[model samples]
Target: MKPLLALALLAALAAPADAQERSGIYQQGEFIDVWNHRGGHVLQMVQTREQLAATGRVVRIRGYCRSACTILTTLPNACLAPKARIGFHAPRIQGTQIIAPYVDQIMGSFYRGGVRERWFGGWNRSREMQVISAREYTRLDPQARFCPSLS
Candidate 1:
């Protein structure tokens, strides 16, 4: 019985990371908060990609978005607050700091064509926290709409 339980545990561990539950609320074409997101597994980003694309929801980047959170920029209705900051870097395995080329390719494919070019041109993978200011981001992605302030 103990051996069977161990096998179950191992199987659970071996399951695809996307099968793991993530924390976020989905409300169709309403608001999405991709703010202050440091990012985790690439699979999580991929799993959410369809929802983001399908809903045409407004993704609000009101704070710092690092790593996979940058994927939000790919959404058709993504928007940034005036003070929002988006961070980018090569995809790396969590905890180990080991770079994953396949994950990086997945991330690279998410970026808009021009944004991809600009990002690749200026990116420094070694730095691991290159930030794009709201102003600069707007310059690079002219189609990225801005959210209106409630005040």
Candidate 2:
């Protein structure tokens, strides 16, 4: 009986955490900050681009997502919540105000073609934060699943 109990404990320990509980707004630069502070283990997890790609779970953007958070747009299953808002701006080096073109390019590339054109097409010349309204977001990706609240 002790052996069986030990096996059960091991099984429970090995079980993956609930993905939904882990789901939340991945705010801008949060990933970068975690990576920098924790190196590889962002709380016992390796925060890698590949890891981000492998996340088949849905990402619900319910609030402002900026900078590094924009990368979440590329997740296999990404959705915008009813009141979700996204902020776009030129990338800046962590902890500094200097703009970084390479980073900006990477972020821009993650967006869908039409989204890129509409958001970056005009009126954002100064690299200031440009907000994309929930209405426009639904327009751009009509097929995208909306958060339950909106439905």
Candidate 3:
């Protein structure tokens, strides 16, 4: 029983590592091109979000952007590679028409916390941006002007 339990625990610990996807960078000319080497494109958003939040730095990731990936792009620091396959379509309505509200909802989240927009849905802006630290995030709530997370 003890040996079996130890094996189970080890497997559990190793599971996430196995599940976690990673990107590979290849030297292409003067640039280091990054590609999803493991897992699916969906993991890109989750990992990038966590990494940016923890480090509070600019992040450049490449992958197909659509569906849930759109939601993940709400992170202020997100930048989609120009060649990435980015597609946005409305959710199916009844059988034929597409729902417009889905676009609004996705864009709304982008407005709420992600990018600051002088005009909505304008591609003229660069997606590359910076994330506010925990201190800056809380400055909105005058009660907590200082966040220990900033330290």
Say which prediction, candidate 2 or candidate 3, comes out ahead on TM-score.
Answer: 2
| TM-score rank order | 1, 2, 3
Write down the TM-score of every candidate: 0.71, 0.57, 0.31
lDDT of 3: 0.35
lDDT of 3 by residue, 54-96 (tens): 4443333344444333433345544345333333333333344
The sequence of per-residue lDDT tens digits that candidate 1 reaches over residues 1-151 is 3432343345545544452232232232256545466767878877665666665557666667677777777677777878777888777767776776677667777786566875567552544578888777878777776777411
Clashing pairs in 1: none
Question: lDDT per residue, candidate 2, 60-134, as tens digits?
Answer: 555555545655554555566666566666655556667654554555565665666754674223367677766
* Candidate 2 root-mean-square deviation in Å: 10.2
Q: What CA RMSD would you report for each candidate?
A: 9.9, 10.2, 13.2
Question: Candidate 1, 26: how far from true, in Å?
Answer: 7.8
Q: Report the CA-based lDDT of candidate 1 relative to the real structure.
A: 0.64
Best by lDDT: 1
What lDDT score belongs to each candidate, Candidate 1 first?
A: 0.64, 0.48, 0.35
What stretches of model 1 exceed 4 Å from their correct place? 1-29, 122-124, 149-151
